[model samples]
Target: MKKLLLTAGISALLATSAVAQTIGVSVARFDDNGLTIMRNGMTDHVDTLDGVDLQVEDAQDDVARQLDQINNFVASGVDAIIVNAVDTNATDAMSVAAASAGIPLVYVNRQPINMDTLPDGQAFVASNEVESGTLAAFQMCQDLRAQGKSGGAQAYMLMGQLSNQAAVQRSKDFHDVIGMDMCNFITLIDEQTANWSRDEAQDMMTNWISSGEPFDAVFANNDEMAIGAIQAMKASGLSMEEIVVGGVDATADALVAMQAGELDVTVFQDLAGQGAGSIDTALKLAAGEEVDKTVFIPFKLVTPENVADFLN
Candidate 1:
């Protein structure tokens, strides 16, 4: 009887030791196409791990709600947490909450404002913003020159949500690229934010079309907005061949647009890779292992010539 009791106790201890590590994830919103792919990647990758559990929540694009989720994760004693921030500038409180609780935190896809000041066991995982818009705009510049627009060309800009770091950097990238001598012939006629909404972008594009501006190109911060602009131009009876359209995030819909000869250029930001990397980083951090504070997945330029290679 004594031996049996000892054996039972050992088995119980082994079972306890095999308990899965839990990770709490708070995404900015679940309805976003690109972010949905990322969130799916996280869930799929976790499924492959031996002892891991993921608890995902949508912050619904609310800063206060995202902070509350972080606090809740801490209170629940999760081993680690991953956040796809709604407002990149509003992440200081989230970082502090995770740090105070001694839990590992990883910021995925979106950059946090306090990145440079992130405490121990915290990191950011995403593609480099500098590369995203620069690639698209530079490619657009080249495509315009190829089409004999080198003499001079006027273009409109469609920006993403202003609060997100990616949007700010991507917008800056477009301006910087256009400022270069090689691309200086391109003129930016007007710029506006669509708040990363397709419907808003379509409405904004329709308004621009109503202005009867003879723009040569449209540079958008992301594929959804680019698609929106395309839809608006089509509705206005503007030929796709007449204007060069460029955007970041070579999404499936964007690739379809490229195949249909509508979208001219885009930059491929690996949504899945960023998602998986965040999980790996979070797991490492949870285990008290050293990891880079920032992990960047490289961005690739996509055009009609090689768009097929990027198709789903």
Candidate 2:
């Protein structure tokens, strides 16, 4: 009687096996609040799929450490690996290693080049960061132009460090749009690599403001840096309204500031979508399905118009 009952239970579970799949994700760091939210969103989304087993490992923004983490997942024979690269350049070797071991990798949020060319079944998913930068600049330009300034508007950019893709693409987009005008009406007074740290951005902004560069606006590569620049401004007795500031990666604080009119704009990169789509692609590959080579998450300029729709 016991054996018969066990067989019946197994049969019933088989009926639901279509809803069961385990996916392993390696997130970059827990300290980045944006990434944490995205990871949670991924979990919630995967949970709804039924019987989906999701395991996560944190890389802590260390390059070699992340590589080691992926290697461990490979050794454990995870069905698939989702990698949020710490640096755009750190994962090529590991991508090669994983491919050699027959593991599929879906690179998320940050793009890595030529990984698929090495024979690994590779897929990459992330936001369009170039458009992110361009949108921020474009919005700022429009605002400045509308403010009755006949001359070109001046901007100060607190750039992310060279180590990350966010830095690379955001910088390119910011400059590209400005250059589109032949740059006669725009002057970038100064730019510094803040390494995406709020404190560093604060210090840099303080020094720049103290120097009296006469900047009409501040542009930051990420929300953290934008907030830091705001702090520096406040410390220097400048109101948020006095100097227009904008950023990318629509974090909570930035959104609050934007709503309060303390920030000019922020580009919304849907971190949640990037996370879910990346993991979904990885799982599909593990199940013997083809995954797209690239996925682009749309980015939008978050102003008061659409800020309410995205603030949550």
True lDDT of residue 29, candidate 2: 85
Off by over 4 Å in 1: 1-19
**lDDT by residue for model 2 (1-312), tens:** 999999999988897775566666778787886788788778878877766787798888888888888888888877778888788877778788679788888888877755456354778888877788989988877777767553867888888868778788898888887787543477888888998888999999999988887778898999999999998998998877767788988888889988888888899888898888987788787777876788898998898788998855
Candidate 2 Cα deviation (angstroms), residue 23: 2.3
lDDT of 2: 0.82
State the C-alpha lDDT per candidate: 0.94, 0.82
Candidate 1 lDDT, 213-263, residue by residue in tens: 799999999999999999999999999997999998889999999999999
User: How many clashing pairs per prediction, in order?
Assistant: 0, 1
Off by over 4 Å in 2: 7-20, 115-120
